[model samples]
Target chain A: MTQQKRKFGFETRMLHAGHIPDPVTGARAVPIYQTTSYVFEDTDKAAQLFELKQYGNIYTRINNPTNAVFEERIASLENGTGAVATASGMAAQFAVFMTLLEPGDEIVSSSHLYGGTKTQFTHTFKKLGVKAHFVDPTDMQAWERAITPKTRALYGETIGNPRGSVLDIEPLAALAHAHNVPLIVDSTFATPYLCRPLDWGADIVVHSATKFIGGHGSSIAGVLIDSGRFDFSSFPTIAAPDPAYHDLKFYETFGHYGFLMKARTVTVRDTGAALSPFNAFLLIQGLETLSVRMERHVQNAQAIAAFLAQHPKVAWVAYAGLPDNPYHALAQKYTPKGPGAVFTFGIKSDNARQAGKTFIESLHLFSHLANVGDARSLVIHPASTTHQQLSDAELEEAGIDAGMIRLSIGLETTEDLLWDLDQALQLT
Target chain B: MGSGPSLAVDVSMNTILSEADRAKYMDPGKIRAALSSTKTIAIVGLSPKPERPSYFVGTYLQYEGYRIIPVNPRATEILGEKAYPDLLSIPHPVDMVNVFRQPEECVEIAQHAVQIGAKTLWLQLRVVNFEAARIAEEAGLTVIMDRCVKIEHGRYSGSLHWVGMNTEIISARRGQRYF
Candidate 1:
């Protein structure tokens, strides 16, 4: 018999691409390699492993079979050369900075980002001697103006959190490429199935696999995908000899796999944001259904957005799916599938905060939560929940409405979801 | 494959080929077997609007007991089932991936269907891609281009006669092949 071609589909890759049936037991499902450490066959092999002469599992913190499968599958989906799995989304972001940055290096970031990420960039990174410049994501000129001699990378989300501000990725990628800086996109919201940033000129992509990628709202994991297209010859981090790894020049040795190699061997090994094998299994399950869930998420969001837009109580809706949205055109070009399921809307009332509270409380189907991109629809009143600490002036400066209602549409029946929103809106 | 080589398919052809003409390119038995065995379908570019033929076909298929997964980014749900933005995003097994998209979009969807392990790729009426069909067939998936699954099911399942439509199938076996 002739050997068959092994060109599998996306779902096939999700189930079988990164793995084969166990030679020992004929097991079909990916077995969770849950051991903490692997034993070496001999002193010579162990020595070679320690010397980085050969690649093999030594420790779970450095690499594991389960995590490797998750990493490879995501890398395939994202159209990346390689990927490094981390403990969480924040860890993935940290690993990127840890691998690329020096003491005096700077990062140009979008002003609109998850509050946690903003704090990490502004406070945590500053303490580590790296400065960050925040710029409006919509203004390409502003991004250019923020870049300085010390700047190493440009960072932004595929879709802005809370506000649903879509990034003009192509222009920003151009800006970063012109300056010889890598554009790192947090594509957690717009998964690779919807938009592959690397195809549009991005150098790096990061994701909080805890959300949609994990679909059922279980497990927390992150991944960093390298396009392997960026030239790191000028960057001292990847190009120069690493004292930690005994003079291993990542760029010179690994070539296209340089970034991922450094991220794994240096950042992940030292910082230790390694994903658990069990969590990797959960993520695998999520990845398998990502296509279907994302479509439902988009459909539910479209229905809810239409409902909110026509409601007399809704002051304004800021969903890219909506025709009047400022980012509609950009979203259509970059993410033609859908503008994503998460969006923000203003609830109108005499005391907008009271109305927001009523609307949130009245909903039985939608869960009031801090997270986004779950299998279940989630709602949060930003002014009262996440942005409660910000003063009214500060909230306005951040472009957050006091009565803003953020919705993360999930995989649910449209009729039930619409009914839930309708009942809640009537109360408001 | 739709035609021997994608290069062989003329770009100027404006209509679907006749059964005899298509027989030169594909096997009808492959499509019949795919429809008979398929249990779940992930419909790419499924519209939420009721008027769309994709919606009605999907609804009718769902009513017939085949699991229908809606694949479109704009809608979260269709006919009570959670929708996916693309074929790759669907977490479960898909027996077939039905395309309700433009011919230009077929290649990407074909790649996604292959990646997702879908057993077959069924392109709706008037939408066809020889390149996509070639890719799917090469990947070992059964490919049925420029045909409606509902029409195929009704024809093969002996349901078309009840609706007064010609099944074009001549056989003594008139019972449903699919349960």
Candidate 2:
């Protein structure tokens, strides 16, 4: 097989970068490697694979052919060295953190993040002795001051979950590099089609492929892509000799691919958060039409956000695509393609919780659910659903309000979504 | 709260340093020369505790074979080195006055670094003062702000890749030994 030389466009790469015709069966699409393990050619080959002397399929848990294609394709799209696919988006982020940090390490993360991620950072990571420092994403000094000697990573979302606050990746990356820490971006909202965080200097980008990457929301998958830029030599977890791999130095051995290799060989091998090949295949299908789907997604979202901002019943809209939004300039600087499709707006009513409930219940076109980045529109009341356990003060800290209605605009026509929202607001 | 406006002014001044000027100070060659040739580093605000960044970076620099002079008024000695009360109190010649102080304190330190005839003035990560940099640069000293010396050493000395940063260089094979 010959490697392609010319750099293809984003849409073209989305369709064709990682896979080619299968030589065995001449299959045109990515074939699911549904088996558990790969057979070794001989004892020498098996020993070489086990020793990290060579790279190939050893076990389905560590590496799968279909998942490898998905990984490569996403990495290419993200302009990264390589990627590791995991069972879910949360798992992908967990694996990357596992590879970068030890028990005593710390991460400075944005306050505006996915609810699931906040819970993981505040709860799960705390149990492992990893501390999370949450700071306002818009406050650069807060991020800087939060960095301590033990800080191993800086983390944020490309476009904040539900809030749609655009991250200033370049400045944040500069700050992280100044401290010799890597910036990890959760770019699930602004998928590579909208924004490539690595191009803005992020060291690693993770995604919940179950969302935008699996456009139809068919697969629960996630990926971790190494920007191949973060200098990790001073970073103990990736650079140091690991007893699990028989004292093999990952960075010394893999060079630019150290994180990807470690995440696969050590973290995935030990933790077992591998993505299934079938999910990888589904994600690949979503990847093929990502460019087109995202175009429609943005168009519909921009229109709905505009409509909501002007509505009499709407109290506030937080989409960065709006010219008046605080993150509008950041959106222009970072995600020039679009500010993304997920956003939230507050209902102007006295009984906001009841109003939000009525609005969501009345929306015939939008699906009231837990997920985003689907072909079908989604509506969720965070204060009533995802974040219901929190008190009023906690809700305020999470940037969620009782009246706030989170919308994940889909590929549906702008008129239909507007009608659904307008009728719902009237009902409320 | 009383220091808000002046700090804002300082940040604004720091932003005026253009990309080209910032690049001049942070040049890999310049960093390499500064790291390899400098023998003594006076670490201002070097903490006694192991958890502080000053202590951690100062220790790393010490391990890398530089003479680390801890500068703290409260501590008589730290990291097995005699701690000076100030840059002016260090009796011996200093190669670099590496500051771990706040941004507001840098201008005075830069002046002291110049008075002491130090070769370089290095502000640690998140400490940037354009006026201090100018004062030091005008006094014929190399000025590097908002960059960690330990990271620069790891990068230029070819040890950074061992941990996994791209370092923008690739090799067909891994043969050379690292520090």
Candidate 3:
């Protein structure tokens, strides 16, 4: 099949780029190849494929053609050399850590991260003999101080989950580079459409495709994009030959594609985090209109943020898009397009807990769901849902108070969104 | 405290629907009855493969005697039934319309179910629309939310195995098994 040129804008590229007409039947759409094994050319070719002598599908658990197209598309969008698709966003991060770090290695990460990421880093990774050092993402000195000889990477999010604080990516990236480590960013909130962290100096990017990338909330998938900028060769542990895969050195064989090759061959190969072809197909369809849907998402979010800021019943609002927001400058520095469509606000009521619950139950248009980045508006009380596992102090540290409510604006009419918010606030 | 029964009876009587409605709608009795009566179900999103939840759920329900009608616009058939594009397009009046579409699209399916005169509108777990529920209710249909009918059937019909138990006696001979 002739590969189509990647010439279209974000919207068009999303729909067409990195994918071509099926050579066999000329099918216009991506066909889900639901099979366990692929037909090898011959015995020698199968040996070459397994020996990492050539790239070809060996098993569905490691890779699939349908999923490869998705990985390629997202890597192109993020301006990365290559990407590794995973079963879910958490699995994507796990692949990154497992491929990059060994026992006793440390990761310097931001305090303001998604609860799941925090748990994975602080608890799960700890059990694996890796430690996590938490610091404020905006504080470059703190990040530098947190780094030690054992520090393997610096991690933060483009837009912190729930808290919505935009990180200063450039300075942090510089700090990580100076410390001989790469910056791993969770860009799930501010997807490449809003801000490409690779363009700003991030060395690696990960996403919960379960969110924005699967905009319609139909599937759970994730992707890890390698910027091809980080010189992993400086770290002999990762650049050297792997004893598991026939002593093949990733950096020597793949060069710029070393990180992604290692992640795919080792992490995904062993742990089995490969995304299903069906989910990948669903995400590709979602990506087709991502650029268009994101614009309306930002506009709706900004308008709702403004309306909530001025409402009598609102105690506080945290949206980087707002001029008075603490992270507004950082948002401008990193994401000039828009801050994103997710933000948190607090309702002013004596029984804020009950009021928040009541408000969520009262919403007509906005569905109360744990997931975000849907085609329809969604609302959640973090104190009761997402951050419920944390105590009062931990919740406060995570910037989630009892009155805090997180809103993920969708591609709905701004008037309808505000109307729903207004009625819900009145009930509160 | 002494008037609790009478007060409970008064509240139950004044409720929008009676105990029968609760038993029919919220309770698993209606689903049990449906399972006993029907042998076929037309799940609109059933895939051909077994990995998908829709495929597994539909297959499981079919295992319990309900025939699954996989309706897909692209597929010729799924699991032996001729896949129809829509409910109206189906040859027979299906006992239930199991939807796997997003919540926003449920209103149209509810309307279609009403048009096809389906006996039940089973919106799969995590997909619900109050407006659709109201419309179905007005059209004399039963609506259940955030529930899997297969799971309910397993729970209410005593067909599932349970392992957890509380015990007092340490010896095996004296130990009690509460059914």
lDDT tens per residue, model 1, B70-165: 999999999789988888788889999999889999999999999999989988766778899889989998887766777566544433322112
**Number of the top-ranking candidate, with lDDT as the measure:** 2
Which candidate, 1 or 3, would have the higher TM-score against the true structure? Answer: 1
Off by over 4 Å in 3: A1-8, A388-394, B1-179
TM-score of chain A of 3: 0.96
Q: Residue A366 in candidate 3 has what lDDT? A: 96
User: With candidate 3 superimposed using the best TM-score fit, by how many Å does residue B155's alpha carbon deviate from the native?
Assistant: 54
Give the winner by DockQ: 1 or 3.
1
In model 2, where do residues sit more than 4 Å from their true spots?
A1-5, A389-394, B1-179
Sorted by lDDT (best first), the order is 2, 1, 3
Instruction: Classify candidate 1 by CAPRI docking class.
Output: incorrect
* Sliding window of 10 residues with minimal summed lDDT for model 2 chain B: B1-10
Question: Which model is ahead, 1 or 3, in terms of lDDT?
Answer: 1
TM-score of the A-chain for all models: 0.97, 0.97, 0.96
- What's model 3's overall lDDT? 0.76
List the pairs of residues colliding in candidate 3. Answer: B39-B67, B40-B67
